[model samples]
Target: MRHTWRWFGPVDKVSVREAAQAGAQGIVSSLHHVPTGTAWTTEEVEKRQQEVRAGGLEWELVESIPVSESIKTMSGDWKAHIAAWQQSLRVLAKAGISTVCYNFMPVLDWTRTDLRWETPIGARAMRFDLIDFVAFDLHMLQRPNARAEFSAAVIEQADARFRAMSDEKKAALSRNIGAGLPGSSDGYSIGELTEALGRYAAIDAGRLRKNLIHFLSEVVPVAEELGMRLCAHGDDPPWPLLGLPRILSTEADYLEVLRGVDSMANGVTFCTGSLGVRPDNDLPAMLRRLAPKIHFFHLRNVRREEERMPCSFFEAEHLEGNTDMVAVIAAIVAEEKRRKAEGRSDHQIFMRPDHGQEILEDITRGAQPGYPAIGRLKGLAELRGIERTLSHASYGLA
Candidate 1:
């Protein structure tokens, strides 16, 4: 696997040179300044490429070209947005970039209730506390039918939790959940969130799935023609949130997507942390089954607080969470061998240390949440060690 690091363009606190210094061979980036629904110009693509090249690293993949809300909902100006997306892909291919990753989660991107939950070792990691989320949903956002979504026991717990919070904590919780992540297109105020939720009133899981298929059916051919791979990222929590449908959460969901598109150009971005949040997902088995269609990997892990649905989880160390990191890497190594034996061109996959805790100098640096420098470097070193050991011992690869 090619080691890559995600870098937000010029504005990011973590520079491209820093990513290179941390041992990343490539940079995963996007034209974040380009607004959603706008076609990317060749100049912009080349400019970002130049920035990455200046750091002595290549821009390997586009972390995302934000899928516009119109395209996801198939609402106002949806066709135009699709055209722009295709245009962006063409521009990227013209610039010598082949792999792209995007997601279809409604309203928000990857979210967490706490951005700096201090671990026992004094490192700060992101966390998603179920009780806190429920409290926000019921008392803060006050979405209709929100109470019905939770069990009576959970509702009681949420009420108590909400009551115990001071006004400052309440505001912080709302900001953490409603405000979008680093590269997300836009964040929502409370009223804006409610309005966005209303747009999806008629769209359920089935309808959303169809919309995604329609998108792939339209865009996958363009990608195929250009010999580019378009990988859909899995939902962050791997479950529905704010009553929105989460279609790309499980193995069955991915199978349905692959079947729906039925093209190598349409693929999956295998993210261990996201999918591993669900206990039933057998990571190694799923990797083996979907190896042929997986074009990108986010190798991270999370520790689940409970065994039940809607349970809370915190980002754990790469090898310390519920996921069997050794087994997962072994499966990947085996898949690479199979692809090589088959004489396939895309034999080596692109992977990154998805997220890391804030440790050491990371605490004072104020790097993007879950994207600290030393933290990710530590993760990359650990992952590289595992991959090398597995390749030499089991797969017999140099």
Candidate 2:
């Protein structure tokens, strides 16, 4: 595994030098300033590559090249958007940036009900509360079908949660849910967000899955030709929110997409925190089964409030969460070993110690929600230690 750190850009609070010093060999980032549906030009790609090299780090993966809403719903200039995405891949491949990550989550990228949920030790971590989310969906956003999506018990809890919140709390809740795309500073107002959700009202889970398969059918061929690995990130909470169906949340979901595309280039990002949120996921098992096609990995843990879907969760310490971190890492190392034996050039799968607890100076550094410096450096150190110990022990030489 190649140790990678996510850097937003030159404007990022955590500079490339800081990431390199933190022991990251590669950078996971994207052209955040670029708008959705636009092809990333050769000049732009090379410019960012130069910046990474200057900071003594290789740009291993573009965490995303945003997939447009038009592409998701197959509406309003989606063909042009698809063409632009293909062209962007061509340009990126020409620039020698072959590994990329993107997600198919509708409206908001990853919803966190609280950005600074206080931990026992006084540190903060991102938390997703089910009741808060339901409150936002049913009472705040006032979606027409919100009641149908949940049980009366769940609805009652949400109603009670909504009723207890102050006006200030309600506004903060709105802003948090409307917290738009990852990496982008832009967000939406309640009105704008409600309208965005409305666009998907006619599109159900089956249609959404078809849209994803169709998308892969169009783009995976381009990725294969370009020698690129196009990885789809799993849904953050791994459940439907605001009536939007999450098609990429489970192992079955991935198998369907990979088989639909039928190419090595169509791959998975293998995010533990996201997939592990669901108790049924079985992280180590999923990694072992899907290892060959997992091009990138987001190694983090989440403390689940329960074993059910739509349960509340908070980002936990790398080794302290419900996820068996040691086993997950072992599976990854095993896959790397297999790939190396097979003479694969891309044997080293890039992984980042994702979503560390906001501890130490990170508390006031105002770093990106989950991308704090000191905390991630700490995580990388812990993960590196595990890899070293495991690697040494696995060699049965006398």
Q: Considering every candidate listed, which one attains the maximal lDDT?
A: 1
Mind giving the per-residue lDDT tens digits that candidate 2 earns over 1-398? 89999998887888899999999999988999998898899889889999899899989889898999999999999999999999999998888789889999988898899998899999889999999999998888888867888889888999999999999999988988899776797688888988998899899888998999999899998998888999999998899888888998999999988888888899999999999899988999989999999999999999999777779999999999989999998888888888998999989888999989889899999888888898899999999988877777555210
Q: What is the C-alpha RMSD of each candidate to the true structure, in Å?
A: 1.1, 1.5
The 10 consecutive residues of candidate 1 with the worst lDDT sum are 179-188
Predicted candidate 1 versus true structure: per-residue lDDT over 206-317, tens digit per residue: 9988999999899999999999999999998988899999999999999998999999999999999999999999999999999999999999999999998789999999
Question: Any runs in candidate 1 off by more than 4 Å, and if so which?
Answer: 393-398
State the C-alpha lDDT per candidate: 0.91, 0.90
TM-score of 1: 0.98
